[model samples]
Target: MEGHIVLKNVQKSFGPKQVLRGLSVSVKKGRSLVVIGGSGTGKSVMLKCILGIIRPDAGEIRVGGESCIGLKGKDRDAFLARFGMLFQGAALFDSLTVWENVAFGLIQGRGMARHAARDIAVEKLSQVGLSSDVAALYPAELSGGMQKRVGLARAIAADPEIIFFDEPTTGLDPIMADVINNLIVDCVKRLGATTISITHDMASARKIADDIAMIHKGQIIWQGEANKVNVSGNAYVDQFIHGRADGPIQMDVLKA
Candidate 1:
Protein backbone atom coordinates (compact mmCIF):
# COMPACT_ATOMS: atom_id res chain seq x y z
CA MET A 1 0.00 0.00 0.00
CA GLU A 2 2.94 2.34 0.48
CA GLY A 3 4.01 2.26 -3.13
CA HIS A 4 1.51 3.16 -5.83
CA ILE A 5 2.87 0.55 -8.24
CA VAL A 6 5.44 -2.24 -7.95
CA LEU A 7 6.74 -4.46 -10.72
CA LYS A 8 8.96 -7.35 -9.74
CA ASN A 9 11.01 -9.12 -12.37
CA VAL A 10 8.25 -8.78 -14.94
CA GLN A 11 8.58 -10.73 -18.16
CA LYS A 12 6.48 -10.97 -21.30
CA SER A 13 6.85 -12.72 -24.63
CA PHE A 14 4.93 -12.98 -27.89
CA GLY A 15 5.64 -16.07 -29.98
CA PRO A 16 9.42 -16.03 -30.39
CA LYS A 17 10.06 -12.43 -29.44
CA GLN A 18 10.63 -11.81 -25.76
CA VAL A 19 9.64 -8.39 -24.57
CA LEU A 20 9.96 -7.32 -20.92
CA ARG A 21 12.80 -9.24 -19.32
CA GLY A 22 13.19 -9.33 -15.55
CA LEU A 23 12.00 -5.77 -15.23
CA SER A 24 11.67 -4.35 -11.75
CA VAL A 25 10.56 -0.87 -10.84
CA SER A 26 8.53 0.93 -8.21
CA VAL A 27 6.42 4.07 -8.58
CA LYS A 28 6.02 6.06 -5.42
CA LYS A 29 2.85 7.88 -4.50
CA GLY A 30 2.23 11.33 -6.04
CA ARG A 31 5.39 11.29 -8.14
CA SER A 32 6.02 11.33 -11.88
CA LEU A 33 8.15 8.61 -13.47
CA VAL A 34 8.95 8.64 -17.17
CA VAL A 35 9.95 5.57 -19.14
CA ILE A 36 12.08 6.41 -22.17
CA GLY A 37 13.00 4.01 -24.93
CA GLY A 38 12.97 3.47 -28.67
CA SER A 39 9.94 2.16 -30.56
CA GLY A 40 10.25 -1.58 -29.88
CA THR A 41 11.98 -1.68 -26.54
CA GLY A 42 8.81 -2.99 -24.86
CA LYS A 43 7.79 0.33 -23.36
CA SER A 44 4.18 -0.03 -24.52
CA VAL A 45 4.14 -3.73 -23.78
CA MET A 46 5.29 -3.10 -20.21
CA LEU A 47 2.47 -0.62 -19.79
CA LYS A 48 0.00 -3.06 -21.29
CA CYS A 49 1.03 -5.75 -18.85
CA ILE A 50 0.59 -3.36 -15.94
CA LEU A 51 -2.85 -2.40 -17.25
CA GLY A 52 -3.77 -6.08 -17.55
CA ILE A 53 -4.43 -5.65 -21.26
CA ILE A 54 -1.69 -8.19 -21.85
CA ARG A 55 -0.79 -11.03 -19.54
CA PRO A 56 2.84 -11.38 -18.62
CA ASP A 57 4.64 -14.68 -18.96
CA ALA A 58 6.21 -14.22 -15.52
CA GLY A 59 6.46 -11.66 -12.71
CA GLU A 60 4.35 -9.81 -10.21
CA ILE A 61 2.53 -6.51 -10.67
CA ARG A 62 1.17 -4.91 -7.55
CA VAL A 63 -0.97 -1.81 -7.25
CA GLY A 64 -1.51 -0.45 -3.76
CA GLY A 65 -0.03 -3.65 -2.27
CA GLU A 66 -2.44 -5.92 -4.13
CA SER A 67 -1.35 -8.32 -6.85
CA CYS A 68 -3.08 -7.30 -10.06
CA ILE A 69 -1.61 -9.79 -12.48
CA GLY A 70 -4.53 -12.23 -12.39
CA LEU A 71 -7.42 -10.19 -11.07
CA LYS A 72 -10.83 -10.83 -12.66
CA GLY A 73 -14.41 -9.52 -12.84
CA LYS A 74 -15.25 -6.84 -10.26
CA ASP A 75 -11.82 -7.14 -8.75
CA ARG A 76 -10.23 -6.14 -12.01
CA ASP A 77 -12.65 -3.27 -12.45
CA ALA A 78 -11.91 -1.98 -8.98
CA PHE A 79 -8.19 -2.04 -9.69
CA LEU A 80 -8.72 -0.30 -13.02
CA ALA A 81 -10.81 2.41 -11.36
CA ARG A 82 -7.68 3.68 -9.65
CA PHE A 83 -6.07 4.54 -13.00
CA GLY A 84 -6.52 7.24 -15.65
CA MET A 85 -4.91 6.77 -19.05
CA LEU A 86 -4.19 9.20 -21.89
CA PHE A 87 -3.61 6.95 -24.84
CA GLN A 88 -1.21 7.76 -27.67
CA GLY A 89 -2.85 9.60 -30.62
CA ALA A 90 -5.60 11.02 -28.34
CA ALA A 91 -7.95 8.15 -29.09
CA LEU A 92 -11.35 9.84 -28.86
CA PHE A 93 -14.75 8.74 -30.01
CA ASP A 94 -15.40 10.54 -33.31
CA SER A 95 -19.12 9.83 -32.97
CA LEU A 96 -19.33 11.81 -29.72
CA THR A 97 -19.04 15.50 -28.99
CA VAL A 98 -16.07 16.77 -26.98
CA TRP A 99 -18.17 16.89 -23.82
CA GLU A 100 -19.54 13.45 -24.54
CA ASN A 101 -16.01 12.11 -25.00
CA VAL A 102 -14.95 13.61 -21.70
CA ALA A 103 -18.02 12.23 -19.97
CA PHE A 104 -17.79 8.76 -21.46
CA GLY A 105 -15.86 7.27 -18.52
CA LEU A 106 -18.19 8.88 -16.00
CA ILE A 107 -21.34 7.65 -17.72
CA GLN A 108 -20.11 4.24 -18.81
CA GLY A 109 -17.61 3.31 -16.14
CA ARG A 110 -19.06 4.97 -13.04
CA GLY A 111 -22.69 5.18 -14.12
CA MET A 112 -22.93 8.94 -13.61
CA ALA A 113 -25.95 10.81 -14.91
CA ARG A 114 -25.42 12.51 -18.29
CA HIS A 115 -26.23 16.02 -17.07
CA ALA A 116 -23.94 15.91 -14.05
CA ALA A 117 -21.18 14.22 -16.03
CA ARG A 118 -21.44 16.82 -18.76
CA ASP A 119 -21.06 19.64 -16.25
CA ILE A 120 -17.97 17.99 -14.74
CA ALA A 121 -16.68 17.32 -18.24
CA VAL A 122 -16.94 21.01 -19.08
CA GLU A 123 -15.15 21.95 -15.88
CA LYS A 124 -12.35 19.50 -16.60
CA LEU A 125 -12.16 20.85 -20.13
CA SER A 126 -11.78 24.37 -18.80
CA GLN A 127 -9.04 23.16 -16.47
CA VAL A 128 -7.16 21.95 -19.55
CA GLY A 129 -7.61 25.42 -21.18
CA LEU A 130 -10.43 24.35 -23.48
CA SER A 131 -13.43 26.66 -23.45
CA SER A 132 -16.92 25.44 -22.65
CA ASP A 133 -18.03 26.27 -26.20
CA VAL A 134 -15.73 23.58 -27.58
CA ALA A 135 -17.66 21.00 -25.56
CA ALA A 136 -20.49 20.83 -28.09
CA LEU A 137 -18.20 20.33 -31.07
CA TYR A 138 -17.12 16.89 -32.25
CA PRO A 139 -13.49 15.82 -32.18
CA ALA A 140 -13.32 16.17 -35.97
CA GLU A 141 -14.06 19.87 -35.66
CA LEU A 142 -11.27 20.53 -33.19
CA SER A 143 -7.56 21.00 -33.85
CA GLY A 144 -5.00 18.40 -32.77
CA GLY A 145 -4.10 20.38 -29.67
CA MET A 146 -7.76 20.74 -28.76
CA GLN A 147 -8.29 17.02 -29.15
CA LYS A 148 -5.35 16.30 -26.84
CA ARG A 149 -6.74 18.72 -24.28
CA VAL A 150 -10.08 16.93 -24.43
CA GLY A 151 -8.34 13.61 -23.96
CA LEU A 152 -6.50 15.03 -20.95
CA ALA A 153 -9.78 16.32 -19.49
CA ARG A 154 -11.31 12.86 -19.84
CA ALA A 155 -8.29 11.26 -18.16
CA ILE A 156 -8.71 13.53 -15.13
CA ALA A 157 -12.53 13.41 -15.14
CA ALA A 158 -12.53 10.52 -12.68
CA ASP A 159 -9.82 12.02 -10.47
CA PRO A 160 -7.92 8.76 -10.31
CA GLU A 161 -5.12 8.03 -7.85
CA ILE A 162 -2.72 7.12 -10.69
CA ILE A 163 -2.40 8.41 -14.25
CA PHE A 164 -0.74 6.85 -17.26
CA PHE A 165 0.35 9.20 -20.06
CA ASP A 166 1.23 7.54 -23.32
CA GLU A 167 3.15 10.04 -25.47
CA PRO A 168 1.26 13.05 -24.09
CA THR A 169 3.13 15.55 -26.27
CA THR A 170 3.23 13.67 -29.55
CA GLY A 171 2.09 15.31 -32.81
CA LEU A 172 2.03 18.86 -31.47
CA ASP A 173 4.12 21.91 -32.21
CA PRO A 174 6.85 22.69 -29.67
CA ILE A 175 4.86 25.54 -28.11
CA MET A 176 1.72 23.45 -27.87
CA ALA A 177 3.70 20.57 -26.40
CA ASP A 178 5.04 22.81 -23.68
CA VAL A 179 1.54 24.05 -22.94
CA ILE A 180 0.27 20.49 -22.64
CA ASN A 181 3.21 19.54 -20.42
CA ASN A 182 2.48 22.45 -18.10
CA LEU A 183 -1.17 21.50 -17.94
CA ILE A 184 -0.23 17.92 -17.15
CA VAL A 185 1.96 19.05 -14.26
CA ASP A 186 -0.78 21.34 -12.95
CA CYS A 187 -3.52 18.73 -13.16
CA VAL A 188 -1.45 15.96 -11.60
CA LYS A 189 -0.33 18.25 -8.81
CA ARG A 190 -3.88 19.34 -8.07
CA LEU A 191 -5.09 15.75 -7.91
CA GLY A 192 -1.98 14.44 -6.09
CA ALA A 193 -1.78 11.54 -8.52
CA THR A 194 1.19 9.31 -9.20
CA THR A 195 2.01 9.23 -12.90
CA ILE A 196 3.92 6.97 -15.29
CA SER A 197 4.57 8.48 -18.70
CA ILE A 198 6.01 6.80 -21.79
CA THR A 199 7.53 9.24 -24.24
CA HIS A 200 10.39 9.64 -26.71
CA ASP A 201 10.18 13.44 -26.42
CA MET A 202 13.02 14.51 -24.15
CA ALA A 203 11.57 17.98 -23.62
CA SER A 204 8.31 16.55 -22.43
CA ALA A 205 10.14 14.05 -20.25
CA ARG A 206 12.36 16.70 -18.69
CA LYS A 207 9.36 18.93 -17.99
CA ILE A 208 7.15 16.23 -16.53
CA ALA A 209 9.34 13.66 -14.80
CA ASP A 210 10.75 13.56 -11.31
CA ASP A 211 12.66 10.42 -12.17
CA ILE A 212 13.80 9.05 -15.52
CA ALA A 213 14.30 5.42 -16.49
CA MET A 214 15.77 4.35 -19.81
CA ILE A 215 14.89 1.01 -21.36
CA HIS A 216 16.89 -0.82 -23.99
CA LYS A 217 16.52 -4.26 -25.49
CA GLY A 218 13.52 -4.99 -23.20
CA GLN A 219 15.33 -3.95 -20.02
CA ILE A 220 15.94 -0.80 -18.05
CA ILE A 221 19.56 0.19 -18.62
CA TRP A 222 19.57 3.25 -16.43
CA GLN A 223 17.43 5.08 -13.87
CA GLY A 224 18.05 8.21 -11.87
CA GLU A 225 16.61 11.54 -10.84
CA ALA A 226 15.73 13.87 -13.70
CA ASN A 227 18.49 16.29 -12.77
CA LYS A 228 21.03 13.50 -12.77
CA VAL A 229 20.13 12.33 -16.28
CA ASN A 230 22.90 14.36 -17.92
CA VAL A 231 25.50 12.51 -15.88
CA SER A 232 23.91 9.10 -15.87
CA GLY A 233 27.12 7.79 -17.51
CA ASN A 234 25.11 5.23 -19.43
CA ALA A 235 25.82 5.31 -23.13
CA TYR A 236 22.25 4.48 -24.06
CA VAL A 237 20.89 7.29 -21.90
CA ASP A 238 23.46 9.70 -23.30
CA GLN A 239 22.71 8.67 -26.84
CA PHE A 240 18.97 9.01 -26.30
CA ILE A 241 19.01 12.37 -24.45
CA HIS A 242 21.48 13.99 -26.83
CA GLY A 243 19.79 12.50 -29.91
CA ARG A 244 23.09 11.14 -31.12
CA ALA A 245 23.50 8.77 -34.06
CA ASP A 246 26.75 7.17 -32.93
CA GLY A 247 26.25 5.35 -29.63
CA PRO A 248 25.90 1.95 -28.07
CA ILE A 249 22.26 1.76 -29.15
CA GLN A 250 22.03 0.45 -32.69
CA MET A 251 18.82 0.62 -34.67
CA ASP A 252 17.83 -2.46 -36.62
CA VAL A 253 18.24 -1.47 -40.25
CA LEU A 254 16.83 -3.65 -43.02
CA LYS A 255 18.76 -4.24 -46.20
CA ALA A 256 17.24 -3.48 -49.58
Candidate 2:
Protein backbone atom coordinates (compact mmCIF):
# COMPACT_ATOMS: atom_id res chain seq x y z
CA MET A 1 0.00 0.00 0.00
CA GLU A 2 2.90 2.31 0.69
CA GLY A 3 4.06 2.15 -2.91
CA HIS A 4 0.91 3.53 -4.48
CA ILE A 5 1.57 6.54 -6.76
CA VAL A 6 -0.93 9.30 -7.40
CA LEU A 7 -0.48 12.24 -9.75
CA LYS A 8 -3.40 14.64 -9.86
CA ASN A 9 -3.84 17.49 -12.33
CA VAL A 10 -0.13 17.62 -13.09
CA GLN A 11 0.98 20.22 -15.60
CA LYS A 12 4.43 20.99 -17.01
CA SER A 13 5.81 23.44 -19.53
CA PHE A 14 8.99 24.71 -21.12
CA GLY A 15 8.62 28.42 -22.00
CA PRO A 16 5.79 28.62 -24.57
CA LYS A 17 5.53 24.85 -25.02
CA GLN A 18 3.21 23.23 -22.54
CA VAL A 19 3.86 19.49 -22.21
CA LEU A 20 1.73 17.91 -19.50
CA ARG A 21 -1.72 19.45 -19.52
CA GLY A 22 -3.51 18.44 -16.35
CA LEU A 23 -2.24 14.86 -16.58
CA SER A 24 -3.58 12.64 -13.85
CA VAL A 25 -3.07 8.91 -13.19
CA SER A 26 -2.52 6.47 -10.39
CA VAL A 27 -1.15 2.96 -9.82
CA LYS A 28 -1.91 0.84 -6.79
CA LYS A 29 0.84 -0.76 -4.75
CA GLY A 30 2.30 -3.95 -6.21
CA ARG A 31 0.68 -3.37 -9.61
CA SER A 32 2.27 -2.73 -12.99
CA LEU A 33 1.19 0.18 -15.19
CA VAL A 34 2.46 0.53 -18.73
CA VAL A 35 2.11 3.85 -20.57
CA ILE A 36 2.15 3.72 -24.36
CA GLY A 37 2.32 6.67 -26.76
CA GLY A 38 4.17 8.05 -29.72
CA SER A 39 7.21 10.22 -29.11
CA GLY A 40 6.85 13.62 -27.38
CA THR A 41 3.66 12.54 -25.59
CA GLY A 42 5.07 13.56 -22.19
CA LYS A 43 5.52 9.94 -21.08
CA SER A 44 9.19 10.37 -20.17
CA VAL A 45 8.47 13.86 -18.83
CA MET A 46 5.91 12.42 -16.48
CA LEU A 47 8.44 9.93 -15.13
CA LYS A 48 11.00 12.69 -14.66
CA CYS A 49 8.44 14.76 -12.82
CA ILE A 50 7.62 11.88 -10.50
CA LEU A 51 11.32 11.25 -9.87
CA GLY A 52 11.93 14.95 -9.13
CA ILE A 53 14.34 15.04 -12.06
CA ILE A 54 12.02 17.73 -13.37
CA ARG A 55 9.63 19.63 -11.16
CA PRO A 56 6.11 20.09 -12.46
CA ASP A 57 4.87 23.58 -13.26
CA ALA A 58 1.78 22.74 -11.19
CA GLY A 59 0.06 19.75 -9.51
CA GLU A 60 0.44 17.07 -6.89
CA ILE A 61 2.60 13.94 -6.87
CA ARG A 62 2.03 11.67 -3.94
CA VAL A 63 3.78 8.37 -3.36
CA GLY A 64 2.32 6.19 -0.64
CA GLY A 65 0.28 9.14 0.68
CA GLU A 66 3.30 11.43 1.02
CA SER A 67 3.86 14.51 -1.14
CA CYS A 68 6.88 14.12 -3.46
CA ILE A 69 7.15 17.54 -5.04
CA GLY A 70 10.03 19.84 -4.14
CA LEU A 71 11.83 17.18 -2.14
CA LYS A 72 15.27 18.38 -1.03
CA GLY A 73 18.62 16.91 0.05
CA LYS A 74 18.27 13.75 2.10
CA ASP A 75 14.53 13.63 1.50
CA ARG A 76 15.10 13.47 -2.24
CA ASP A 77 17.81 10.87 -1.82
CA ALA A 78 15.60 8.80 0.41
CA PHE A 79 12.74 9.04 -2.04
CA LEU A 80 14.95 7.96 -4.91
CA ALA A 81 16.31 5.03 -2.91
CA ARG A 82 12.83 3.51 -2.95
CA PHE A 83 12.76 3.43 -6.74
CA GLY A 84 14.86 1.79 -9.48
CA MET A 85 15.02 2.81 -13.12
CA LEU A 86 16.01 0.87 -16.21
CA PHE A 87 16.63 3.73 -18.58
CA GLN A 88 16.14 3.75 -22.32
CA GLY A 89 19.08 2.15 -24.18
CA ALA A 90 20.23 0.56 -20.92
CA ALA A 91 22.23 3.77 -20.15
CA LEU A 92 25.08 1.82 -18.63
CA PHE A 93 28.24 3.60 -17.60
CA ASP A 94 30.92 2.58 -20.08
CA SER A 95 33.61 3.24 -17.52
CA LEU A 96 32.30 0.74 -15.01
CA THR A 97 32.29 -3.03 -15.20
CA VAL A 98 28.93 -4.81 -15.16
CA TRP A 99 29.18 -5.84 -11.54
CA GLU A 100 30.45 -2.42 -10.50
CA ASN A 101 27.60 -0.75 -12.30
CA VAL A 102 25.09 -2.99 -10.57
CA ALA A 103 26.68 -2.36 -7.19
CA PHE A 104 27.10 1.39 -7.69
CA GLY A 105 23.91 2.32 -5.91
CA LEU A 106 24.54 -0.05 -3.03
CA ILE A 107 28.09 1.17 -2.59
CA GLN A 108 27.51 4.86 -3.26
CA GLY A 109 23.95 5.42 -2.13
CA ARG A 110 23.69 3.11 0.88
CA GLY A 111 27.44 3.04 1.67
CA MET A 112 27.61 -0.75 1.66
CA ALA A 113 31.06 -2.32 1.47
CA ARG A 114 32.24 -3.29 -2.02
CA HIS A 115 32.53 -6.99 -1.25
CA ALA A 116 29.01 -7.26 0.13
CA ALA A 117 27.57 -5.06 -2.63
CA ARG A 118 29.30 -7.16 -5.29
CA ASP A 119 27.82 -10.33 -3.84
CA ILE A 120 24.33 -8.85 -4.17
CA ALA A 121 25.19 -7.50 -7.60
CA VAL A 122 26.27 -10.93 -8.85
CA GLU A 123 23.12 -12.45 -7.44
CA LYS A 124 20.96 -9.81 -9.13
CA LEU A 125 22.81 -10.36 -12.38
CA SER A 126 22.16 -14.09 -12.03
CA GLN A 127 18.48 -13.37 -11.55
CA VAL A 128 18.53 -11.56 -14.87
CA GLY A 129 20.24 -14.58 -16.49
CA LEU A 130 23.74 -13.09 -16.61
CA SER A 131 26.51 -15.36 -15.39
CA SER A 132 29.12 -14.27 -12.82
CA ASP A 133 31.78 -14.33 -15.55
CA VAL A 134 29.88 -11.74 -17.51
CA ALA A 135 29.84 -9.48 -14.49
CA ALA A 136 33.53 -8.68 -14.92
CA LEU A 137 33.05 -7.41 -18.45
CA TYR A 138 32.15 -3.88 -19.55
CA PRO A 139 28.88 -2.80 -21.15
CA ALA A 140 30.63 -2.31 -24.51
CA GLU A 141 31.68 -5.94 -24.47
CA LEU A 142 28.14 -7.23 -23.98
CA SER A 143 25.50 -7.66 -26.64
CA GLY A 144 22.53 -5.26 -26.73
CA GLY A 145 20.34 -7.83 -24.96
CA MET A 146 23.03 -8.50 -22.41
CA GLN A 147 23.44 -4.79 -21.69
CA LYS A 148 19.71 -4.49 -21.08
CA ARG A 149 19.91 -7.42 -18.70
CA VAL A 150 22.74 -5.73 -16.82
CA GLY A 151 20.74 -2.55 -16.57
CA LEU A 152 17.89 -4.60 -15.12
CA ALA A 153 20.30 -6.18 -12.67
CA ARG A 154 21.39 -2.71 -11.51
CA ALA A 155 17.79 -1.61 -11.12
CA ILE A 156 16.89 -4.51 -8.84
CA ALA A 157 20.18 -4.77 -6.99
CA ALA A 158 18.81 -2.47 -4.32
CA ASP A 159 15.49 -4.34 -4.14
CA PRO A 160 13.57 -1.11 -4.70
CA GLU A 161 9.92 -0.84 -3.71
CA ILE A 162 9.09 0.70 -7.08
CA ILE A 163 10.67 0.47 -10.53
CA PHE A 164 10.42 2.80 -13.50
CA PHE A 165 11.23 1.15 -16.80
CA ASP A 166 11.89 3.53 -19.67
CA GLU A 167 11.52 1.58 -22.87
CA PRO A 168 12.92 -1.59 -21.37
CA THR A 169 12.70 -3.60 -24.56
CA THR A 170 14.17 -1.06 -26.94
CA GLY A 171 16.99 -2.12 -29.30
CA LEU A 172 16.48 -5.86 -28.86
CA ASP A 173 15.33 -8.54 -31.29
CA PRO A 174 11.73 -9.68 -30.80
CA ILE A 175 12.81 -12.95 -29.22
CA MET A 176 15.17 -11.22 -26.81
CA ALA A 177 12.57 -8.58 -26.06
CA ASP A 178 10.19 -11.31 -24.97
CA VAL A 179 12.90 -12.78 -22.80
CA ILE A 180 13.36 -9.41 -21.08
CA ASN A 181 9.62 -9.10 -20.67
CA ASN A 182 9.44 -12.49 -19.00
CA LEU A 183 12.31 -11.53 -16.70
CA ILE A 184 10.57 -8.27 -15.82
CA VAL A 185 7.39 -10.12 -14.90
CA ASP A 186 9.37 -12.59 -12.85
CA CYS A 187 11.35 -9.88 -11.05
CA VAL A 188 8.34 -7.68 -10.32
CA LYS A 189 6.34 -10.62 -9.05
CA ARG A 190 9.20 -11.62 -6.79
CA LEU A 191 9.58 -8.12 -5.32
CA GLY A 192 5.89 -7.24 -5.47
CA ALA A 193 7.07 -3.80 -6.55
CA THR A 194 4.86 -1.07 -7.95
CA THR A 195 6.00 -0.47 -11.54
CA ILE A 196 5.52 2.22 -14.17
CA SER A 197 6.94 1.36 -17.57
CA ILE A 198 6.85 3.54 -20.68
CA THR A 199 7.20 1.68 -23.93
CA HIS A 200 6.01 1.76 -27.53
CA ASP A 201 6.32 -2.03 -27.77
CA MET A 202 2.85 -3.50 -27.45
CA ALA A 203 4.22 -7.01 -27.00
CA SER A 204 6.20 -5.89 -23.97
CA ALA A 205 3.26 -3.90 -22.63
CA ARG A 206 0.78 -6.74 -22.99
CA LYS A 207 3.19 -9.14 -21.37
CA ILE A 208 4.14 -7.16 -18.26
CA ALA A 209 1.30 -4.76 -17.64
CA ASP A 210 -1.68 -5.35 -15.40
CA ASP A 211 -3.11 -2.06 -16.68
CA ILE A 212 -2.33 0.20 -19.61
CA ALA A 213 -2.58 3.96 -20.05
CA MET A 214 -2.22 5.92 -23.26
CA ILE A 215 -0.92 9.47 -23.14
CA HIS A 216 -1.35 11.90 -26.00
CA LYS A 217 -0.31 15.56 -25.97
CA GLY A 218 0.62 15.39 -22.28
CA GLN A 219 -2.58 13.84 -20.92
CA ILE A 220 -3.91 10.37 -20.39
CA ILE A 221 -6.29 9.75 -23.27
CA TRP A 222 -7.19 6.29 -22.03
CA GLN A 223 -6.45 3.92 -19.16
CA GLY A 224 -7.78 0.43 -18.46
CA GLU A 225 -7.17 -3.28 -17.92
CA ALA A 226 -4.52 -4.70 -20.27
CA ASN A 227 -6.77 -7.61 -21.22
CA LYS A 228 -9.46 -5.16 -22.35
CA VAL A 229 -7.23 -2.87 -24.41
CA ASN A 230 -8.28 -4.39 -27.72
CA VAL A 231 -11.86 -3.44 -26.87
CA SER A 232 -11.10 -0.06 -25.31
CA GLY A 233 -13.44 1.48 -27.94
CA ASN A 234 -11.82 4.91 -27.81
CA ALA A 235 -10.76 6.09 -31.25
CA TYR A 236 -7.20 6.94 -30.24
CA VAL A 237 -6.78 3.59 -28.52
CA ASP A 238 -8.18 1.86 -31.57
CA GLN A 239 -5.80 3.67 -33.92
CA PHE A 240 -2.80 2.98 -31.71
CA ILE A 241 -3.26 -0.73 -30.97
CA HIS A 242 -4.20 -1.53 -34.55
CA GLY A 243 -1.28 0.57 -35.87
CA ARG A 244 -3.68 2.15 -38.29
CA ALA A 245 -2.62 5.17 -40.30
CA ASP A 246 -6.25 6.17 -40.93
CA GLY A 247 -8.10 6.95 -37.74
CA PRO A 248 -9.02 9.76 -35.37
CA ILE A 249 -5.34 9.97 -34.43
CA GLN A 250 -3.40 11.66 -37.21
CA MET A 251 0.34 11.58 -37.69
CA ASP A 252 2.19 14.61 -38.99
CA VAL A 253 4.28 13.02 -41.67
CA LEU A 254 6.55 15.15 -43.82
CA LYS A 255 5.39 15.61 -47.40
CA ALA A 256 7.52 13.53 -49.79
Q: What lDDT would each prediction earn against the true structure? A: 0.92, 0.95
Q: What TM-score number comes out for model 1?
A: 0.97
Top model number, TM-score: 2
lDDT per residue as tens, model 1, 1-256? 4668898899998999998898888889988999999999999898899999999999999888889998899998888888899988899999999999999989999899999999999999999999999999999999999888999999999999999999999999999999999999999999999999999999999999999999887888888899999999898899999998789988878859
- lDDT by residue for model 2 (65-175), tens: 999999999999999999999999899999999999999999999999999999999999999998999989999999999999999999999999999999999989999
lDDT of 1 at 167: 95
Worst 10 residues of 1 by lDDT: 1-10
Model 2 Cα RMSD, 1 decimal:
1.2
- State, as a TM-score between 0 and 1, how close model 2 is to the true structure: 0.98
Report lDDT (Cα) of residue 94, candidate 1.
98
Q: What is the C-alpha RMSD of each candidate to the true structure, in Å?
A: 1.2, 1.2
Please identify model 2 stretches exceeding 4 Å from their true place. 1-3
